[model samples]
Target: MFKRNKTRRRRSSRQRGPVARAFFFLVKAGVWFVVLSVGWVLLYKVVPVPITATMLMDPNGHTKDWTPLSRIDRNMVDAAIAGEDGKFCSHHGFDTGAIEKAIAHNQRVDRRGRGHIRGGSTISQQTAKNVFLWQGGGYVRKAFEAWFTVLIENIWGKRRIMEVYLNIAQTGIGTYGAEAGAQRYYRKGAAKLSSIEAARIAAVLPLPDERAVNGATGFTRRHGNTIAARIGVVRRDGLDACIYR
Candidate 1:
C-alpha cells in the first residue's frame, strides 16, 4: 500500500506541466510570504526589534540605545508628530492629503532643469520603511511600504509604531534613536530631553546627515523651532491622543 501511494505521487508529479508547476510554486511562495510577514509583524508587536536592514546597510557605523517609549520624553513624541506627521494619530497608515500635496509641490518647477522633490511619507510609512523595507524609492518599494504600513497599523497599533519609530529612526550620521541622539548631541538621555532638544532631533530626522542637531542653523534651526512651538500644540490639541490613550 505504501509503495502504491508513493508510485501514484511520483506519477502525479511527472504529469504536471511547466505552467502547472509554476502556478503551484507561486501559490506556495505567496502563502509563505504572507505567513512570514504576518509573523514578523506580530513578533515585533511585543518585542523590541533587534535590528533592521537599514542599520546593517549604513556605511557609517551605527549607534543605538533601545529605550522603551516610557523612558522617552513625552515632548519627543509631540515633536515627532508636530515635525513629521500631524495626522499620525488620526490616519490609518497613509495620509492621502499629504501625498497629493507633495505630488503637487514636486510638480511645480522653476527655470532650472532640476525640480524640488519632497516626500509625503508619514511616521507610519517611515517606520515601515525603517523596519521592514529598505531605503530609497521605486514602485516596488512603495508597494512594499504600503503593505508593511498596513501590517503595522493593524498589528503594532499607534503607540507601538511611535515607540519603534523613536527608537529606530536615524538621528544623525551613524547615530540612531532618541536615546543615542540625545546622548550624542546633549550628553544626556532621551528621558531628559527638553522640548527644543526633541524638536531639533525630529527636525533632523528626514535628512539626518545634512541637518545638524547640536547647533542646527538655517532651515534646520527654523524647522526645529517651529516643531518646538508646535509641541505644546500637539499636547494641547491632543494630536498625540491615540498614543497617550
Candidate 2:
C-alpha cells in the first residue's frame, strides 16, 4: 500500500515537469518577440516619409506648408545652426553637457512645476522627435528620442538630418520647412531669400505659423535681425565648418 502511494506521487511530479518547462519556453519566446519587434520599429523609423504631411493641404482640412532641403536657403541653415545648436557638427547624437544642465534645471523647477523649461536636445534629437513621435515631456520620450537620434545620426549624417528637419519642422499654422514658408510669405523659393528674407524666416522659426514675415510684429523683426547677423558669421565660417564630415 505504501509503495503504491509513493508511485502515485512520483507520477504526478513527472507530469508537472513538462508543463513547467513548456511555460518557461513560451515566456522566453515572448521576450524574444518583443525585442525583435522593437528592433524592427527602430529600423523602420530611419526611412524618409513624404513632406506631404507638412506641405500638402487636404481638401477637407488645412495643413502647414513644407519646404524641401534643396529649396532652403544657405543663410537659413546657418541661422538655425547658430541659434539652435552652436556645436551641431561637433557633437555626436547626444550633448552630454547640455543635457546635464537641463536635467539640473528641471530638477530645480520640479518644486513649483512652474520653473523655466530647459532643453538640451540637439537638432538631431529634435528632428527624431518631430518626425517620429508626438509632443510630450518625460524620460520615456527622451530615451526613445535619444535612441532614434543616435540611429538617425549614424544612418543619415548631418546634411540629411538638417534636410529632414527643414522639411518637417513646424513653421506656422499651415507652414512647414523653408520652401513652403518662403513661398507663402515671401513669394520666393528658399534659395532665393536675401539676408533680410532669410532672417525674417528664421526669426519666425520659434513660432512660424502664427507670426508673419510681412506682418509688422516687433518680436519677429528683432529676431530676424539676430538671425541675419548670425548668417553672416556662418558664411564666413564656411559650410564644412558647420556640417560634420
What is the C-alpha lDDT profile of model 1 across 152-240, one tens digit per residue?
99999999999999999999999999999999999999999899999999999989988899768999999999999999999999999
Q: How close is candidate 1 to the true structure, as a TM-score?
A: 0.95
lDDT of 2 at 1: 100
Please, what are the lDDT tens digits per residue for candidate 2 over residues 1-245? 99999999888667777778688789999798657646744554555555443244423333444445556777778867766666778788778898899889988899778955778888888888877665667878777787778777776778888877777776566666777767777777888888877777667665555677787377677877877787777667663364523
TM-score per candidate: 0.95, 0.69
For all candidates in order, the CA lDDT equals 0.94, 0.71
Per-candidate RMSD vs. true structure? 1.5, 7.7
Query: Which stretch of 10 consecutive residues in model 1 shows the poorest summed lDDT?
Result: 107-116
* Residue 89 in candidate 1, Cα distance off native in Å: 0.6
